[model samples]
Target: MENILNYIEINELISTSGQPSVEQFKQIADNDFEVVINLALHNASNAIENEDKIVTDLNMAYFHIPVDFENPKASDVKLFLNTLQALGSNKVWVHCALNYRVSAFMYIYHKYVLKTPFDDIDISLFEQWSPDVTWQEIIKISYDEIKNA
Candidate 1:
């Protein structure tokens, strides 16, 4: 497991992170990841230019959802899950600057979509730090909607 900044492999199916350099993409490729899902905006400080090309060049799919850190929406959560479902069993690496956005969304996915036991995923989700008030609310709202749907 090459060092991807803030990298955490949740399972064989998923990983989360901050931006990794092109060289690090090789490590992801080496690990047999088939998709790179970036939640960071294109203009995000560490966002790499031509990322789609870079990831695809490495023979991996690239899906950019561009989550707004200050204003995460429930729709973004839906889209993230949809993409993962569409990927079937393809290995995925989901990342955002510092892994904040990635972590929040992953928490929802793990708990709601995967039906994972709370205790199984909480420490991994919050190990670095818990989501702030706004993000926590976003997660709650998203989960509530899904539960009620």
Candidate 2:
């Protein structure tokens, strides 16, 4: 059994952070109907080998978010949204070295994209699991860059 960073359910996506075993992925796939987003810093050999096959078989898209979950780049978020929309994928799986990136991204998506209130967020879960690093500043900076772009 490999170590698990985080496992969360967001909408229809099953976002997993960290190195999950083939068995774990299989279990997730079993229950997942839409797509699986892998936000891992590094993927297991089995995952890499079977990714396309599994995605095709399950009718899911595998998105790889390029950023250190703890210290994510704004470009990464932009790319993530772009890729998802480009693929017409509504369901996503966002994972990373830990669930930090996935959680932060969700927060941003809900607050910015979905226009959800900050106070409505489950801050405790994010605060508990996320790195102490301040991503809000980074997100703001990134948002500005995207707006400029």
Candidate 3:
């Protein structure tokens, strides 16, 4: 509801997205998101040049995961979950270039870490466009690790 690009409210505390413009960052500030997490590659076409600065300038926390689209690892998923958990109850905005990466990671997080009901999640990415093979494997591997652990 904050004018974020590709914004999807995973719940009251977490949201996922594509890259947001400068104006949208202000909207995030106005809407009171306490933290911003970015999973996009730094060289991604729409990647903000100084996104950390922008978010911090708006007085929000920023975390960059920089996932490899070609070779997403289970460890990255672990790190993401850890970061989210460490943030506690703070409202967070998680994002990637086109929401492809964000959506995949969110699927694992919501399903495992948060124990969110499967029926509540809108997984149109997996249902419709679907992640590429690499992401699919990452999601599978991450889910397996969570289930096994």
lDDT of 1 by residue, 1-149 (tens): 54778888888888889998999998899889999999999999998999899999999999999989988878888888888879989999999888888888887888778988977884454767777888888767656675343
| Pairs clashing within candidate 2 | 37-93, 39-95, 39-96
What's model 1's lDDT at 2?
44
True-structure lDDT of candidate 1: 0.85
Whole-model lDDT, model 2: 0.57
Q: Per-residue lDDT for 4 in model 3?
A: 65
lDDT of 2 by residue, 4-120 (tens): 445555444434455455555565556654666665554433245556466656665566665664566777777766665564545555555556666776766666666677776
Worst lDDT run of 10 residues, candidate 2, spans 40-49
Report every candidate's CA lDDT: 0.85, 0.57, 0.84
- Compute the lDDT of residue 39 as modeled in candidate 3: 95
TM-score, candidate number 1: 0.90
What's the distance in Å from true for residue 14, model 3? 1.0
Cα lDDT for residue 20, candidate 1: 89
Off by over 4 Å in 2: 1-5, 12-18, 43-59, 69-71, 87-89, 130-134
Deviation from native of the Cα of residue 35 in model 3, angstroms: 0.5
